[model samples]
Target: MTTIQVGLYFLLGAYILFSIFFCTLVLFSTFADSVFIRYLSSTHLGKPVVYHLQQVVEWLEGPKCGICLAQYWSTGDMAPRVMNCGHTYCGSCIEIFAEQKDGMVICPFCTRTHFCNTIHPLPFFSENHLLIILCSSLITVNLWKCQTCRKKYSSQDVSRTPRVYSTCGHTSCEACVESDFTQKKRVVCLTCEGRSGGITVVAENWKPHVPINYAIRDLLKE
Candidate 1:
């Protein structure tokens, strides 16, 4: 084979060889040292950062679990199961999913294949959950549920889907934020209204009767 082809083969062989070592013998050399749990959130291969929660802001942007609707948006030591399909879910949600699929564990989000690595909680799982949830409220750019109307809206929703952001960093999703600019009796921001024409109001200004679009939060997580 050509030199380049031979080098490529050698690299591939080395990677597979090392993967085997990590999976089987080298890591097990000492039970105390066999920190398999540490690697649980680490990507096995090319899995997206979304599959593994590490970065703070990135985690908030990860997709919501399709099954439970619980926000898995924070990256602070959250425990999860990554299926063979590259889909991830919290342990509780995964258990329910597995049971529904005859113990086969199909991905509720994709058709990549099905299998699970369950019970692999990180050492800091519990602590991280609390931290992230608490941070969710304090983060400046995060969404707030209108206490008056109980409608939740993010900063982005106030402006719109952000079709194209302006030089100053403001975005315009005309489809969603058009009414806010119109002279209609009432205008609603995309983040807080279901029907239309509800004025975009801050948490304090929002009506207690309106509702937040929970779905958009999920999308933002993704």
Candidate 2:
């Protein structure tokens, strides 16, 4: 065969290989995304609970706050809070809304007004425990893996505390972080390095301590 013919054949073979790899990557990504979406939907619809309980939970937690349009967190000020009208909003937004209207919090969706004393009196709203549980479950399902060791976080294993690096924001179990630091004498983000083709230096905050990821820890507790 001519050299030109051989070169053309090689080019065709390379293109075929690239196309297969690209298609496989796309398929895998789609599958992962679909799984995540289905889990999210199940949480929203309260599929794991009894029919009656599901209805009640769904009514209490409607995914996001209408005022701020942000998804509820498991804890802290951004956590879901329920008013007297049974409508839920993030704790921060609800407090702001209540204060804006002179201690009368109006539900933006239903236009129902709830009065808060704002002084030494009955609290206007309460934390939505059911919604907090749901949010924590979602977070646990999605982010339970330790980036370094690739081990899953379990409530049974109270020893494993996930720690987030200050610079890279990647999380790994406390054991892995300590081991890595001991071996290398410095903390670096392996995941970031693998992806970006260079060493990504995490802040030297490991000298004194690496802060535990309270958000992940809180979810794992549930």
Candidate 3:
């Protein structure tokens, strides 16, 4: 081969090798621990954060509170509470919903009645501890943003808005429900385009009249 042709061939081979090396470095950096740490640090939750693949799945597919139509907090006063019919709701919202039902609480989703009478005459609700841990893990990484509006679920504001999921496992906020109801006369799922029949006012005194998706929440816990 001519000298110039040989030189061109060598340059092309070097360029291909350099391109491969650059692509490999990019892929490595994408999954590097430092990159994970940068995301963790940006959340401002704390130090020594550990990443888990299962937690990521839970955070992406976790259930939202049917009442108030916001994501479940799963900690402190906002911890999730289960009804006799297997529906779940934010602890505080459930209390407000059941406050006027004597000692009986009704499942808004299934319409099944459950008794929450404390043997010592104290008030209480059934809590899902595993779900709470999953939620807390998501919060630590700041992945609590609602998939619908892309708005972050604020842990500092414990009383922030509520969330509800459709039968198709899609979530929507109380404000969206209200807006759509006023315009369409029914609550619509922004994700699946499913319609919630007969839901006139979902957010009444910060409580939604819809039922929670306990099944999805349980699955995440598992």
Candidate 4:
């Protein structure tokens, strides 16, 4: 083809590809945003625990404050705000529990500080409640999120503590990383790369699984 024709064809192809990509991006963005709004717009947690007693089966009959064991019967309408530890307390009481006497919110009973302050959806649901909501939402609606990988779950659940963590926030279960990759296949913690500290696969069991936890302790001992 002549140079002008070739250039025209290339331009047409580029325009078609660009239009397709733009349309796809717009649709995906709308769907994602709609889902997020619906998730947050929900008052699922505020729906008054019709099955609150189901949570602490033993405490069902004796629904008492998880922090002080103060009976719910003692406190009026200000219902118990349950923490993930399978414990419950008066909302105001837990507010006290979540307060910062020295600018730090520490759990009075378990001493798990600022645990309630993290951004999981608990303005209404606890861990158990969120699990129930997620399952039910999946059945009725197209709600989707992975707790470990999703941003919402991290803010809402505070997350599972990793066996290995990086400064950039890359984390993994020690056993998981150890078993997955082959030798010389570097699994750099995505967040911790170029930062300073992170778990490097020093050895493996199939080839000498030396967990970094052990390595750190040894280095300290040395």
Candidate 5:
């Protein structure tokens, strides 16, 4: 064989070996990150931060409903529902389990048993609003953007704090509301106006009057 052919063969072998090494390194790094995140998730001190790191953990470990092993989403039957034991599962799985067990909810993870009213089984298992919001935020593009300014709301920016209008269920940032208040203009929900063909005016002092949406606030913290 020619020396050129031998050299080319040697280079190909080197390339394959390099590729294998790089892939292995990436796999190991991802595994380590997953382990670290799991450890953090287990600790009480890390509980607060877990919500923020939840997406990273989910990406590394693949988020799933503990009961049915289905991916969590924002709405419908597959939405996250929290049991009395504090473990979350898909709403469909919970409903099925409750039905089969005669309104008895046995948390698959913690093995805690809870009983719902046999007549109405759903009220016992509350919707995991925080997780639902998180899932929705993950799937939707610019879900937290201010309606007026088109700027994304940030937890760090107090001025950009998101507030939901009670009248229309539309969200606007504090900056936009403040701008309206400064000009003594009625703060209107444009989304509601466009949809309902009428102006929906939010209160002049909206911050104090509007109820805080804990779910959205927690999602923003993430």
Candidate 6:
């Protein structure tokens, strides 16, 4: 073929491939939305429960906060909380909303009312440790593998602790590290076969433990 003809054929083929990719993306999005709607319809729960389940499913599929319209955060204030109606929201937003409502707060999505006592600061859905562990563990099971043990980390593990990620982006179960540290004074990286530089002893007589990388935890959950 002539040089110009060959170049033209290449460009045409590239355009066809790009068009196919764009169409596939659109089709996948539409299919996903339809599936979600069908799943919601199948659930016969109350509006509040349905709304919360939708949020949970959406969050599981892709991470984002329904309240603040921001991505999920694992920090103390920004952590995700579940409501009495079984919905989830960011802890910071729920606190502010509760205060504004004078301890009688209603859910915007499902219109469910929840009472808050800021004086005693009773635990909200966010404070439910078991729920937090299960949700976070479900996410962790999908994304992380314990480098040291080569096993998928689950919240249902003996300690039910959140998965710990090192500064090097390697993940390990809390049990494995604690066990190793209890037996040996130094924390070793299972992936690299060396001491992780980020871990340190904070106090005398206290066994050193690796810090939980909340960002990675949040990402996995999301």
Q: Quick one: best lDDT, which candidate?
A: 5
| Residue pairs in clash, model 6 | none
lDDT of 2 at 204: 51
Lowest lDDT 10-residue stretch of candidate 5: 209-218
Better of 3 and 4 by lDDT: 3
lDDT string, candidate 1, 61-170, tens digits: 44354567565645532333333222346656656555566555565566544544344322211222222343355542235333334344443554433221111111
Better of 3 and 6 by TM-score: 6
Model 4, residue 173: distance off in Å is: 23
Each candidate's number of clashing pairs is: 13, 0, 5, 8, 0, 0
Point out where model 1 deviates above 4 Å: 1-64, 73-81, 117-222
Error of 6 at 210 (Å): 2.0
For model 5, what is the alpha-carbon lDDT of residue 172? 62
Model 1 residue 30 lDDT? 37
lDDT of 4 at 127: 18
lDDT score, candidate 5 = 0.60
Query: What lDDT is reached at residue 107 by model 6?
Result: 72
Across residues 38-118, which tens digit of lDDT does each residue of candidate 2 receive?
574468564443344433333344356657877788777888765444456787887787667877778786787777764
User: RMSD in angstroms, all models?
Assistant: 17.0, 15.9, 13.7, 19.0, 10.4, 11.6
List clashing residue pairs in candidate 2. Answer: none
Q: Candidates' lDDT values, in order? A: 0.39, 0.57, 0.51, 0.37, 0.60, 0.53
Ranking by TM-score: 5, 6, 2, 3, 1, 4
Q: Candidate 3 at residue 106, lDDT?
A: 74
Q: What is the Cα-based TM-score of model 4?
A: 0.24
The runs of at least 3 residues in candidate 3 whose Cα sits more than 4 Å from the true structure, single-residue gaps closed, are: 1-62, 117-123, 139-222
